[model samples]
Target: MSGRQEQINLDTLEPQQLAQVKKQLDEELEHLTNSFAQLHAAQNKFKDCLRCVKSRSGAPEDIGTGFLVEKKLKSAEKFYESKVEELGNNLKDLEVIVQRKQTNARTIEEVLRQKILASQGQDQQQA
Candidate 1:
């Protein structure tokens, strides 16, 4: 059935065919779950490496230039952090606006549907 249009309706499938499909789905799910676990482990290891590198970079007092460098790095980090926070707040505001707009759209659609049904009923009565 490769590259061919074949539609198999589950409601009309044979018992054996349904069982085969279920087995294939189960195997695929297992493979995907295992892959996700491996990826999660790799991510954790990467985070650990980052922490280790930061720890090994030495204290600011150990070197004269290190203090100045550390201070500048910290200032930059704070600036980035504040920017991220501001962006996050903006994103939340946008989400609220989107939700309100969606609600309004649904309400409008329902009202239109009711009016159409009422008009159809009146037409039927007149006929």
Candidate 2:
């Protein structure tokens, strides 16, 4: 990378432009949040099913039926575990995106603050 600093004046954007960017970030964050909630719900459902399966009564009268049920439940548990892992990976990706957008918003805010202070200094100087 070159040692020369690249000048990026975020203040060059109009307030409307900043607002639009903020809105986009907010909408994306909201969507990701909803997705996480849905994923959590799915994970919870799987956990609940697993718990229910584990708590089943081991009665000798239903040995054959119990074996079939246990086999199916084990298969379902494996499937749900894989799905949970996939959802977790997706959740991690969304979190990273959200973090990046937050950083961008903060940087823009700092730039706007600087612009305001600079304008104030100019006004004071003109006085």
Candidate 3:
């Protein structure tokens, strides 16, 4: 009854039960074969449809070339837009880093200036 096929002990089954099980298995096999044939026919029909679509020639509008091109252009536009957005974010991050470095450089310059002034004062006093 479940997805798994349970092993039946043929020796334990009565003669009537064994005959009924065999008949049921035969019916199941027939049904499966019929279903497989139907699926194969349907697949062949789809292949025929693909062949027709590929071989038919008409105006670009009639054959959907315009729709396909528009779809492709939209996809490319979205890709480039995303790339531009990513680049913008990267530029903002770089700007922040540059600002931080500039601040650090100014702080170091002020410290050096203070040291120079102190040394000059000490030298003047010694002279």
Which of the two candidates, 1 or 3, achieves a greater TM-score against the reference?
1
**Candidate models: Cα lDDT each:** 0.53, 0.70, 0.53
What does candidate 2's lDDT look like per residue over 1-127, in tens digits? 1246454466687655666766776787688678778877887787677677666655335356556655666677778677767777876777786677678778877766676677789999999
The model with the greatest lDDT is 2
Against the true structure, what is every candidate's RMSD? 14.8, 6.4, 35.3
Model 3 C-alpha lDDT per residue in residues 44-114, reported as the tens digit of each score: 55455545444555543423543754454445556555554554555455455445445544544455456
lDDT string for model 1 (1-127, tens) is: 0136455555455445555655654565455455545545554554555454445544455355535555655665565555545545554554554454455445444554565676689999999
Off by over 4 Å in 3: 1-67
C-alpha positional error of residue 29 in candidate 2 after TM-score superposition, expressed in Å: 2.0
Off by over 4 Å in 2: 1-11, 57-67
**What TM-score should be assigned to candidate 1?**
0.49
Best by TM-score: 2
